[model samples]
Target chain A: MLLIRAIVRPEKKDEVLAELSSAGFNAATMVDVVGRGKQKGIRIGGMVYDEIPKTLILMVIPDDAKETVITMILSIAKTGTGGTFGDGKIFVSPVDEVYTISKGTAGL
Target chain B: MKEIMAVVRMKKTGATKKALVAAGVAGFTAVKVMGRGNLVTDPKAIEACKEKLLSMGMDEFSESWDTEKMVTSFLDGSRFFPRRLFTILVHDDDVPRVIEAIVTANKTEYGIGDGTIFVLPVSDAVRVRTGEAGEAAIW
Candidate 1:
């Protein structure tokens, strides 16, 4: 199984979730977050606001489904002109194990 | 008042529990989420997800999922929260402690799984499910 993690603009979170849900890939989780890009975030109006709000979404899926999910996130989280800062980021990795507490599939 | 939020990537297991206990925030509400990183610079990918959203009768928006399992806990209540979005609201006094716990647990050396953390301020929170007030709506 693979675990997919996504950090997206706060405003786009709902669109991402609704898209993921309609794709028939339910059973995921989401939370609100705050942070800055490696550039230490952006500067606007001389406010010097260090932290920017973001939405963190996570999900678990089979290896074969990885590309589907990745494509889904990118498709929903990109800008029309190539892309820009704070556009969002998606990361994919392997899961050592997944415990099915309800189904009692602890071995998985 | 300050609001804090955290996102951590950890191998889903007892290690997460241990890290939480060590950080002294063993009592956080957790929800599951999923996705992955499209490092290939595929501009259509995020849009594809947006199209998926549009098909579902939702606004089209872009997003990204990095490579790792991310678990996030919202310590302070926040408005604009929608269904299936896990939220938590803490009093002004608890913000610092929760933030500290999240930061400590998210460190690269501590999380057992590759972890990341982030914090954000909140204005208010409302529970559409029952119209609860204050932290009740978030918790």
Candidate 2:
């Protein structure tokens, strides 16, 4: 299985989540975080630079589903008026195993 | 607060549940999540993306008004998607040992792996039922 990690714009979070759910790919983890990039953060009219507030969403998908999930995330998190900075990002890694508690199921 | 606490994953959700139970977490909170590491900065690019979304009929205003509803609706319906998360309130001291257990058991390398563990400094906590405080906050 592949574990997907995405950092996205807080504003567009709903769109991404909704799209993912509608696509039938729910089940993931999320948190709020602070980070800076090469642009070194952001600058407004009067402000200099500062760290950004981002929401980190994580999930594990079957290996065969990587491309589809990636595409969905990108489509939902594209930058702009629709998705601002930190719209969303995805990271895929190997998930050796997964176990959901309410129902005792192993692997995907 | 006990000395050892952990968040573990197993092929058998039963095992993971058993582990958490054995670890002694009273209750846990989790939210669905997703992400990509690649980030960028370009006004034109951002604008174009917004235009594309607009064309698709994703009304920004409606989403802004009610994101929780949107997220739940989307996640419940999607498939073959991204990562999942679980946040457990454990005895703070257990953080290190639990990390050890998960890494060794999962066979993940340092700074690289299928999954990771992160720690956050607990500022303060509260008990919803009685409005308790401090260590009492954890229970």
Candidate 3:
């Protein structure tokens, strides 16, 4: 399995969730986080907001479907017409095993 | 080292923490989250739920409440179910001990939904304060 972690703008969370659900990817965990990217956060007027509020949506999907899922997320998670910094990032990593405590089963 | 990420019932957190600490596991990050696992959210499912809601005399926001947001919330609202996510990064040799601690604390033998534990491969870890990396950074 492959774990996909995406950090996105807070406001884009719902849209991302909705799109994912429609695409038949319903299992996920959501968390609120704060971080900065290459841009080092947002600067509006004169004040620099070094820490920005972001939502992290995490899911572990089958290895074969990695590209499709990532593409879907990137397509929906973009800020505007094209794209810009702090639009957030997606990290992909391999999951060695998954155990369902209730079922006492592994490789799930 | 491996990163053990578990999404378990919120009520089980305290015991799980105590167990891990007692087992000599150094640290973990815990976050409160709403998790939806394999729940059917197809259009048909949403429509049926909307109808059920309407039948229950919840027709005030007829149009607005029929949205995907409403259906999604209905499916995974915290008011109905809230869970805790715990991510523990530990040395490879310590994996079994940590897993045992979590399972024992959770008492998963009792029933289902005790939650899931995912073992992920970690390439490296870094400790900012001391500039340590790899297994040493975790401790």
Highest lDDT scorer: 3
Ranking by DockQ: 3, 2, 1
RMSD of each: 17.5, 15.6, 5.4
- Residue B62 in candidate 2 has what lDDT? 68
Worst 10 residues of 3 chain B by lDDT: B72-81
- Candidate 2 residue A91 Cα shift, in angstroms, is 1.5
Please give the CA lDDT of all the candidate structures.
0.52, 0.53, 0.79
Q: Better model by TM-score, 1 or 3? A: 3
The better-scoring model by DockQ among 1 and 3 is: 3
Candidate 3 residue spans exceeding 4 A from truth = B40-81, B107-112, B126-133
**Residue-level lDDT tens digits of model 1 in B53-99:** 44454323422231111111111111122222112345566655554
lDDT by residue for model 2 over A6-104, one digit each (tens)?
A: 888777777877777666665555567778765667878878566688877766677788898898888878876575554545766564435432222
Estimate, for each residue in B51-137, the C-alpha lDDT of model 3 and write its tens digit. 675566445566654654565566442122578999999989998888877877786543445677899988899999999998899
In Å, residue A90's CA in model 2 sits off its true spot by 2.0
User: Where's the lowest-lDDT run of ten residues in candidate 1 chain A?
Assistant: A99-108
Q: Chain B of model 2: TM-score?
A: 0.48
Instruction: Find the candidate with the highest TM-score and give its number.
Output: 3
